[model samples]
Target: MSSDPRIRLSGVEHTFEGRSGRVQALDRIDLTIEPGEFVSVVGASGCGKTTLLRLIAGFVHASTGTVEVDGECGVVFQRPSLYPWLSVAGNVEFGLKMRRVPRKERRETARRYLDLVGLGEFADAAPYELSGGMQQRCQIARVLATEPPTVLMDEPFGALDALTRENLQAELRRIAKERTVLFVTHSVEEAVLLSTRVLVMSPRPGKIVLDLPIETDPAQDLDTLRTSPAVLAATEKVRDHVQRRTPLRQA
Candidate 1:
């Protein structure tokens, strides 16, 4: 792990107008993610998991505190967002093109990332032609094509069926191995399967209530890893904290 952090949040707070009055989504959110580390945030709904990602992505300003990001960021939203009119490679190439990369080099680089995501053959396919899983993978390749050192993912596989979600989880585990990843997910298994560390947040007006370190070699078989005693213990701990913070819902 690098001594320096790739992303840092200091006393971070965020609030915005809701149907009612201002809703305070996050409070005193102090966190640091080092280079090449996979960090996941898990919380109940309305706990500001998306708000946290927004803070880092600069989609909205924090009502208070500061978020510092060292390098460019690539984001994968809960809903797959791809250019329907563009082919797979065109979508991937779009990012580099925005950075003003040469046309020839952009296509080559986009193809490389497409290949990395196992979508090389579908480079010319339209987004609608692919399955939901394939489209999400294409979205990922598009992000990777931009070569962002820090990636913020807001439930990249949340909509997929269990089998497809699990499959993409494995794929993401592979692709995110060397990147600085901050993922917001509601699934404990997903968090355990992918993150080096998992932070459990309180209910709405969220803040880190528990930070659990996952112990398993990234190269280990995921099934075996999931069944590992360490993982169960950590999951139990995280779930316990979440349960304590959660009652019947009050948004």
Candidate 2:
């Protein structure tokens, strides 16, 4: 892993004007993501994990402080959001096309990433023809095709069944071995399985409650790792922190 910080957030805050009043979504957030690091953000619902992702993606501006993303970033949301009319390879090349990459280079890069995600054979397939898992793989290929130094994922596999989610989680772990990834998810198991560092956020006005390092071997199988004592201990620590911050009514 590189020693330099790939992304930095200092005193980041955001609020929205709701019918009731102004509601704070994030507060005083300070984070640093290092090059080639895999970090997971976990918290209860409404903790602004997605908001933080949007801020980093440049979709939304920070309300209070600075968000400095040094390298290019690719984002994947909960849904694949692939265009049905586009072939798998076409979809993967969409970003490159938008950036006006040469057609030859676009096709070459698209094929490389599709193969990387085990979708090379599906290059000509349409989104509708794919299973949920396959479509997510295409989406990942699309993101990887951008060749960004950092990837931001917001609950990318949250909608999948347990089996599919587990499968993709393993694939994601493999991908993270080659790139910097910042993923947000509510699943404690997913966080423990894929993260180098897990950031636990507090509820409402989200803040980092704990930034815990995950020390297990990154090469361990997801199933075996989840059952390990170290993984269980980390999960419990995160669960306790989130529970302490959650209101009794919600708990």
Candidate 3:
């Protein structure tokens, strides 16, 4: 692996203006994410967690400072974003198709990723035909099919039922082993469970309040890891920074 960071944000800040007035969303965020790390951001609602992801993904530009991503990014939003008219396999192949990849190569790539996400059986199924969880899986497959170096996710499982969310969490953790991921979620436990590092942001005009490392064995099972002392302690620390609005720290 290269020594350089996969993602970096330097003195980053963002603001949004509307009919009402201007609202500052982020403030002085300096972060560095190395390759092959799974990082999660957790904060109170409206704390600009999503904005941070958007900045890195280049969906929105930072009002000041610079945001750098070493390679292309694949973003997965809270809701599944598959085209209704396309079959699951087609949705996965869409990115390759847009790039004009040869038909045979793209189909093979689509099938590979669909199977990786456990959606191979539903390759011919329409988006509406699958349940919410399955639809999300298909969306994830589509993103992975593009083979981006970095993945930015914003509350991808937030709307799912508790059981489904937990299952997907495990699946994501497994799938993220070799991928660089920046995940944003409101759940502290989820952050602790999934991330190699957990970042807590202060309320609106968000700043990094705490940057904590999670030292867990990736090979360990999620259920067992959940109750482990290390995970519990990390969860409490992240929750404290988020709930108490701890002092600012550069991430």
Candidate 3, residues 118-185: lDDT per residue as tens digits?
Answer: 88898999999999999999988899899898999999999999998998998898887778999999
lDDT of 2 by residue, 1-251 (tens): 45679999999999989899999999899899889889999899998999999999999999899999987899998999998889999999999999999999999999998887888999999899999989998999998888889999999998899888888888888876768899999998788779989988888899888888889986678889988999999889878877777432211
User: For each candidate, what is the lDDT?
Assistant: 0.88, 0.88, 0.92
Q: Where's the lowest-lDDT run of ten residues in candidate 1? A: 242-251
**Candidates ranked, most accurate by TM-score first:** 3, 1, 2
- List the candidates' TM-scores in order: 0.94, 0.93, 0.97
Candidate 2 regions exceeding 4 Å error are: 1-3, 246-251
lDDT of 3 at 4: 85
lDDT (tens digit, per residue) of candidate 1 on 4-76: 8999999998889989899899988888888998999988998989889988999999889999999889999
